[model samples]
Target: MNPTAAILIIGDEILSGRTRDSNMHFLAQELARVGIDLCEARIVPDRMQAIVRAVRELSAAHDHLFTSGGIGPTHDDITADAVAEALGRPLSVREDARAILQAHYDRSGIPLNEARLRMARIPEGAELIENPVSAAPGFSVGNVHVMAGVPRIFEAMVASLLPRLTGGTPLLSQSLRILRGEGEIAGPLAALAADYPDLSFGSYPFQQDGAYGAHVVIRGADGARVGEAMTRLAALFPEDRAG
Candidate 1:
């Protein structure tokens, strides 16, 4: 079975509509590419209780839990503390993490001030995730991986963390565009879905130039099975097929 995962987005800005979260989208795609099933996602404010509650719930439910945002140097960046509380782990500035941040700031000709040292505060027994883009590293305690909110830094941290994880067969997907409405195809698609219980099907409708159509997408762990299902789907709708 594929390893299951969840994403926890912790930030007040994201909840306030000031920041559009792109990490979930990126992490979902990347996790799927490596065969980790992203089963759930959530966005919570920077509140300690809210973040702590989500962290416990998601981490308990999934094999892996990735958190994005609220790990910056600002006072509102409370992900570390919340996660530490959630897991009953102590939060402190580790020498190793501090050394990394110190070296980074030193190279950039910036002083490692008190505010900047907050980046080094890690949850006990957590492993540091490398951030090539920025000096502050993300951390993994148990199944929960705490990452930065910035898109660039988050992506970098994911790249560094993903390879260390064990993955299953990559999920394969195939889509067939049909010039028919979802109502026109729902019955057959339902029947088809029943025929291949191992595969998952989706019908996304779209209107282009006043013509209604749907993109029938099939996804599965087995590439051959996915391809076969796509072929069957196309044959079932050959009359209204577009691509």
Candidate 2:
């Protein structure tokens, strides 16, 4: 079976709409590529209790839990502590992590102050995740992987991490754009989906330049099944075929 995953987005900025979350979508796509299903995503404030609660819940429910945000040097960066609390692990500054940060700052001719040192603290028994974009590293304790909220850093961390994980068959998808209202094709789409029970089908509606249409997507682990579903869907709406 494919490993199931959940995403925990921790930041008051995301909750307040001050910052839009791009990590969830990015992680979802990356996980899907490696055959891990992203079953749920939750946004929690920077509060420690809220972070701890979400960490506990998601960690228990999914095979893997990825968390973004709140691991910086700022005061609101309480993700490490909260994760420690949730997992019942002690938090401390590991010398190896501190050494990495120290060398990074020293090479850049910057002072590694107390605030900067905060980044070295990690949960007990966790493995450090390398950060190529930044010196400060993320850690993985149990099934939970803590990562930076910045889009670039998060993407880099995911790239480094996914290859080490055991993934099932990669999911394959095919899409066909139909220049017709979703309602017009709803019945046939449903019947097609029923006929291909092994595949998953979705219809996304769009209105462009005063024209309304839907983009139908077929997805499955089996490429032949997805292709067959796409062909059937195309046959059902030949007049509205896009390209």
Q: lDDT per prediction?
A: 0.94, 0.93
Superposed Cα deviation of residue 117, candidate 1 (Å): 0.7
- The Cα RMSD in angstroms, rounded to one decimal, for candidate 1 relative to the true structure is 0.9
lDDT of 1 by residue, 124-196 (tens): 9999999999879999999999999999999999999999999988889988899988999999999999989
Model 2 stretches with alpha carbons more than 4 Å out = none
In order, what is each prediction's RMSD in angstroms?
Answer: 0.9, 1.0
What pairs collide in candidate 1? none
Assess every candidate by TM-score.
0.98, 0.97
Look at candidate 1 and tell me the lDDT of residue 54: 95
lDDT of 2: 0.93
